[model samples]
Target: MYWHIEDSRYRIANPIQYLISKLGLSMDSLSQFVLGAAVSTAFLGRKIGPRKAALVGGVLGTLPDLDVLIPFADPIDSFVYHRGWTHSVFVHALAAPILGEGLVRLFRGLRDHRWLTWMTVFLCLSTHAVIDAMTIYGTRIFWPFYPDPVGAGSVFIIDPLYTLPLLGVVIWALFRRNWTSRLQTSVVAVLLGSSAYLGASLAVQRHVEQMALEIFSDNGGKPERVLAIAAPFNILVWKVIGLDRDSYRNLYLSLAGGNEPLEVYTHPRNPELIACLEDTPAYQKLDWFSRGFNRAELVDGRVVVSDLRMGLTPGYAFRFVVAEADGQDIRSVTPKRDLSLRRADAEDFAWLGDRLLGIPAARAAEAGFQSTTRDRAAFDCSTD
Candidate 1:
C-alpha cells in the first residue's frame, strides 16, 4: 500500500486511540516499516561494507514508493502513480542489477565481491516489493514481465498485526549484531506468521459476513449490498454497512467481539443525492474516475463529492474530496476532511426525503470543540 509520507507526518504526537479513531493506524508504524527494511539490509550486508549496506538499505527503503512522483509528470495520471511501476517485481529485477553494478564502481572497496553485492541488492529490493503485494491494494508486480496485479487482499493498509512483529524482530536484531543465528530466524518467523494471520483474518471476516447476511434476512430486510470491515486487529469491533432493497434503507451494525451478530442501527442511504450531479460536467468526469465508489451529497447548498474508495472517515484520514459542480470560487480540497459533516450525516438526506420522518445537530462536537463554533460560510451555490 502507498503510505504518503506527508500524510504520516501530519498525525504526530497523538494517542493510539486518537490515531485509530482518526487516521486508522499508529503513525509509528510508518517509521518502523521503513526503518526496519533499512535495518534488515544493514543486518544482511555488513560484509559488503557499511556504506554499501546503508546504500542498499536506503534504496530498498525508498524504491517501492518511487511511483509517488509520477503525478509530477502528468496530472491525468495521479491514481496511476500509486501502486505503479516501482511496485512491480519486474522493475525491481531490472533496477537491482543496474544498482548493484553502479554501487560496485562507486564504492570501490566492494569491487571484488560484486556478485554478493548484486545478490544482496536484488534480495533487499525484491523483499520490499513482496511485502507490499500482501495488502488489499493491488500491485502490478510483474508489469510488462506479467501485466497482472498480484494482490493477496489479506491485510489492510494500517495493520498493526503485520507491522509490530516485524518491528519487534528488527529492534531485537539492532541490539544484537549477529545476523545468521537467532535474529534471522525470528525475522523470518514474524514476517511469515503475520502473513498467515492476515489470511486467517480475511477468512474469519468472510464467515462473519455470511452470518450477518442470515441475521439481516431473518430480521425482515434483505441487504442489496454489504461491506464488512474488521476494526483494528482482533475483529473485536466489526463495522457492517448495508444497502437495502430500496437503497435508502441504509443500516450500520457495530458488532463487538464478532460472535454476537447485531441487527443494525437505524440509518438511511442517500444514493439519490448522486442524482443532483446530473447537472455538472466535473462531477461526471470524477464519477468516471471513481468507478462507482463515488458518492455525492448536498451540504450547505454546495455538493460534497466523496470518493469512498479512499478513507472511511475524515479528519486524520486521507481522501480525494472535491467541491460540487457549481461554477464558483470554491478553491480546492485537500487531504484533510471537512469536519462539519460525515458520511453518516450525509445519509440524513434520505430522512429529508421522508418529510414525515425527520430530525437533526450541534457545532460544538461537530467542530472538534467543547463549545459551538461559527460555520465559515463557503461558496453558496443556491443563489447563483
Candidate 2:
C-alpha cells in the first residue's frame, strides 16, 4: 500500500501531496477500495439491482481502510499504524452485521435478503485485506490474534495493469440497465484475466529471485534474503536486492538485459550510525518492520535512517532523523518525520525508462548519485 501514496494519503503536509491532489491521480487506501468496490458491485449487482449493489459495495469496500484517517505523531508512526489492526479479518466479522443491518434499514429493498447484504459487506472488508496482503508492504490481516504482518510481495500497490481491467468492467456494468447473459460473460472474462495476470506476475518474481541469488553468489557472497520488486509501472524490469550478513546488494534486471553483467550496487547498513541508539524501542520497531533492509546516514549533523524497500537507493521515501549526533555520540534519538524524498520529476522518470531499456545513459545515472549515500564506491562518511 506504500505506492498507494500516488496522490497517496500519507502526504505529511508536503507540496507533492497537494500537487497529486490537483492531478486527480490517487493510489491511496481509499482509492484502492473504490476500485475494488466498483468491480465487486458490478459482479454482485447482477442478481440484485445495480444501484443498490453499488451503494453496498462502494460504501462497504472502503470501511476497512478507515485506518488512514487516524493521524500519528510522525510519518513513521503513521506508516506503522496503517494496514495494521483495521485491515484485520476480525474487523470484517465484527463489522459486517452492523454495516449490513444498517444498509438493510436504509434501503428497505434489502430487508428480504439480509443474509445476501451481510455477505456482500463481508466480501468488501475481507477483499481489502487480501489485496493488501498481495503487496510487498506489510498488512496485519490476522491482527489481535497474531501481531505480525503478512506480505506476499507479489505486486506493487497500484499496478494499472491490475486495476484498469476491473475499472473497464465497472464502467461497462454501470451503463447496463440489467445484467444480461452477455454482461455476465464480460464480467467473468475480466475477473479471470485479472487473476491470471496476478499469477503471471508472481511467477516472474520467482524467476527474478532465482537469478538474483545466483548473481549474489557469483559476486563472492551468499544471499540471506532476496527481494525482486517490479519497477514503477511495468513488470518487464525489476530492482533486485539481496541481503547478506554484511550488507544489502542491489541490481537492476530487465528481460532485455539477459546474460550480461548486472552492475550490482552495495549498500552497507552503517550500523555505526545507530550504535548508540540500537537498543531504543523506536529503533527496534523500525528494524523489525523494515526486515533489516534499512540504512543509516549522517546528513546535516543528524543521523537519519530510511527503509530501503519503499524506494530506490540514495533517496528513499521514508526517512527519519532518528537522532541528534555530535561526532558519533548521540545526544538524543527520537522518531521525527523527514520528508527528504522529492517527487520523481520528468528527467528522473526518463532515467528510469532508459534503465529499463538497458541504455548507456542509465549507467551514468548513479555515477555521482551515491555521493550522498552509503554506496561502497562513494567516499567514506564521517559523522563529524
Best by lDDT: 2
Of the candidates shown, which would achieve the greatest TM-score relative to the real structure?
A: 2
What are the TM-scores, per candidate, against the unseen true structure? 0.62, 0.85
lDDT of each: 0.48, 0.68
List, residue by residue over 1-384, the lDDT tens digit for candidate 1.
434433343345334423444454333235334443545444543454333354456556556676665544322235433566776766777777788788778766568877876776666666666655654345677777675555443445566666676556555654553345454566567756865876776786676667667767765476776555553333433444455422312222333322332324433223444444434544454455443444544456444655443434332132334444354334333223333433333333342222212222111212231211222243333212
Which 10-residue window in model 2 sums to the lowest lDDT?
A: 371-380
lDDT of 2 by residue, 267-339 (tens): 7766666565566666666777787777777778777888777667666757777777665356545577665
> In model 2, what is the error at residue 221, expressed in angstroms?
1.6
CA lDDT for candidate 1: 0.48
